[model samples]
Target chain A: MSAFVSISLVYLAIYTLSAWSLNLQYGYAGIINFGWIVFQSIGAYVAATTALGSPTSGGFQTYIFGARLGFPLPLIMGTLAGAALALLLGLIILTRRIRPDFQAIIMLVVAIIAAEVVSTNTALFNGANGLSNVPQPFNGVMHLSYNNYQWFFVAFSFALCIIVYFGLEWICRSSWGRALRAMREDDILASHVGINVQALRIVVFVIGGAIAGFSGALLVEFLGTWSPDAWSFVESFVVFVSVYVGGRANNRGAIIGAFLVPVVFGTMPSFLPEFGYPGLSANLEWLVIAALWLTTFYLRPAGILPEGRFIARRTRAREQAPVMPPIAKQGSVA
Target chain B: MNLYIEAIGFGVIAASSIALGAMGFTLQFGLTNVLNVGYGATMSFGAIVAYAAHLTGMSIWLALICGGIATSGLTLLSAKTLLRVYAKRGAALFEMAMVTFGIALIVEYAIASITENNTFSLTIAIEHTHALGPIRFTDVQLALVILAVVVFILLDGFLRLTKVGTALRATAVDPDLARASGIATGRIVTIAWLLSGFLCGLAGGVFTIDILTVNAFTGDSLLSLVIVAALMGTAGSVRGAALAALLLGIATQLVSAAGASGYASAVAYGVLAVVLLARPKSVQGGLVADRVQITV
Candidate 1:
């Protein structure tokens, strides 16, 4: 395969993972977390910091948590870091009697602040230059060929995606999932029904963060580098677009949507004809994405496939019976 | 001590830009009740308009007016054509915000594509600074502060005294109730949009003059700060926004002066976080989670 295809696939895998995490949060849980990319950035930073080893006396950059974690530790650390931050923020913002829109703005502000902090403090991940020279997982031991590595990642990413997909599907299908749906529909009512709404949101938010981190770990290790540029507020929007374009509540829909939007729409721009200037094409690509967002909302407000409404059996019976038909209950049929 | 004074002076300048943006933002938000994320894009358009006018040998003041006019036209047009459509379709508050966000992306990206993502610089001629005690400011900065103060006094007077302003305030309180009271809610909404759009444009132009540079993401970068200021001031309070902007501006300056220049914006953000965490209840009305189905 050509370099372009390989690189595209790498981005696709990472974005797919990110979208999956968003799907779990916004889709199943109905949490309007506008600041979605912070978790991804955290995951990337943690993974990078852990894998780069310690900054020696003559080192060029400085960072905290600088230690060689080898293969699995970096990934674990990344996931945990993302989850921890989410838990902390969730406790503060997700609680309280504030408005959801305000909650979203707060999240966006938090993301902006996170980016600023990371860009400023060099010790926090080597500042804006970011962490590079990151070794691939198992490169020395496996001694894999280039093609082999690509295939290995493909298989590995696919396996993880499958596991996450199924794991999330199970969670969404269980009683816990029903509780979440209840909270999404009406938090106050859910609380009245004995559901600890705040706790539930925090738990799901943390889990979502972990998934985002895990995805970032998989991505950084595959690409062999991570930086502030790797994550931006725009990254959050990309995943969000996919979740909305696909069915919001369906896991399968989320994956399919992610592939279509990010893998296809996002990558296609690179191959387009050169526009007026160098970055013009990239700018037009975003224009197209924005147009797509508007068009989808206008054409398919409920997405390609709308989420199935879960009707209680008791309510289902009443719906079927129809207390009074518009046409006198079809007297002839009776 | 000198550095502290200088920071304070610079903070006031920054606050002037933020105050202009926030007032317009709050008006549109208060009356229409749409978050209007496209606000930043509109500001960018205004800046571009001003830049184009400048290239045509127009005076900066005239160019500023042109920018404000352009922004006002676009805001009213978008509100009538695009926003009305979604709003008519029963799109909720959050969905309206998403729609505006998408529109903003289109506007910003179009500008970027056309401009080739290059930054443009606009120099303001204000070499001389006046010293008062330890604080000093250039003629331009002084002008900005005066303009801000005038705008505040005028807005406050308008809101309190004028019939149109009364109607606007009434609509903000309850659109349905305002309509029932024989007030033309639609006309009031249009007035709010026009005024807000004009101010937004003026803010962008002023910002470019101060920073001496404009880019595609200029408005996007400042948007978070603007929102923070508006929200911290309680969204509907013009005076509150001014006060918040002043606080933010000073805090940012102080941080930069303290040698943590890279984290200056973070300091502003840190203030926002503390406010958010400390009094989440204060922001309850603004935080109501509305279901918005966004797709791309």
Candidate 2:
């Protein structure tokens, strides 16, 4: 039970990080990154390959870019790889004024094709079987027992999660974050008001990609394996559901959604007694997730905790007059 | 040379299936402005229904019709009921796509649970092999090609000659104006859903017959190619979709023949990217209205 709790805590951190990244991208910047899983998968593969040591010719598993990197280096490389990939994709997809729906479809296609490419190119990442036996960070140096190591890892993960949570909060509260919200609301208006929409999109995309990559690295280090099956296009939908359910543009809502959707609803089913066929529970879990997604969209489109209005601090003159708030409210009403 | 020729033959067969699906997809999207990502799931459901009908001792052709009918009803029902709910709730264009995706997940996973996640092999007996020049096709393949051609002719005629088809075209261009012109836009939208759904189901049946396998994911796996074909063409132009489908089908087969079978779909998508990059205006122009209103 303790081991399960440790693992669940680690997953909670990872999912929370992913949801926050997606919230930054879709919820704030209005960039619908339907290919979000590809960024995460690239991070995991990079981290696993870098830490797994050199591959031998005709070995049990073959993968490119194999090296024995130190713990922090692998994680850093993973994050960098994610940002680089996001830069490349964002340059191609975001430079133009494509319709948002069309852009999303292109992303979805990219994700599906990426999976196919990875699975078929065995020499790249050992094909469908995927790369396993990834070395754990600090396992040898600490000389701790397995359970103790799990708890240590859990603490480390939580520490990172807290750091990311606060970092994102700072970013979301900053002027740049305000620009992202403006872009989400209306990119044309944001641009007219001096926001470099294209550059802003690419930058936010890279930041979100870096976060996704960092989470993937952390997950791969703990799990000690990375596979194509783990990062299917549908996996991105899981994170999207989290952001939508939690509440867009709200960091607290992202945390709540990460906990409720991926951690509670996504993982809790496996703990139940096996009743039907082997994979029935898994299928049913997806059904429930989909149903939950639709229900959330229908009942509370603004989510359980809608984004609060950001009213500017009142100046002395404004406070004395007290005239602008009603006008603003009337404009919104009209 | 012979390898390329044989690939062309295979491409033609593949194009038939793709064209069927793409035409239906483009038609629905043009008229309704919903991306309908659940289209693939509906196709899978249709194929499953056809397989069940075949099990009940019906002829394969009749089973295919049953599949088409089932999907048509499903698509119409969802459009009238489920999609209507979301649109009325003020879901934006992209949100509607997400809604369809959720619907897809529900239908796909429900089917997966019921089917026990098994890939059922379809035993379609090929009675004869016909050779035209260097390319040989089984009886089923020949029939598929003929079916595609007949459907294309019929659809083109319907859209060009008929008054209702003109109304659909007009409404697709401007729904508000069509309504002002005394066209019952609601009825036209309903017909669009029913017709497109039938075509989508037929495409699924033909795709299953061609592949000779049935699974929940099969239709979805083919959806990317369908989408590419649909997008490569103009939104509402059947001719453009047919041309694009042919191009993609031939390109995919040619790539596969060049020894990288896995990268064939990627190559097809690459073509779309190039088109998008080169002629951004032509592909996306006039398709997206300044204000996108869901015409359910």
Clashes in each model (backbone N, CA, C under 3 Å)? Answer: 7, 0
| lDDT (tens digit, per residue) of candidate 1 on B37-125 | 89899888888888889989999879988999999999999888888888888776666777888889988998887788889988777
RMSD of each: 3.8, 4.1
Cα lDDT tens digits for candidate 2, B152-243? 99998999999999999999999999999999999999999998888888888899999999998878967888888888896778888989
Off by over 4 Å in 2: A312-334, B282-290
lDDT of 2 by residue, A253-313 (tens): 9888898888888987787789888999999999999999999989989877778775434
What TM-score does candidate 1 reach? Answer: 0.93
Tell me which residue pairs clash in candidate 1.
A99-B287, A99-B288, A100-B287, A100-B288, A100-B289, A101-B287, A102-B287
How does residue A144 of candidate 1 score in lDDT? 83
Q: Which one is best on lDDT?
A: 2
Model 2 has a DockQ score of 0.49
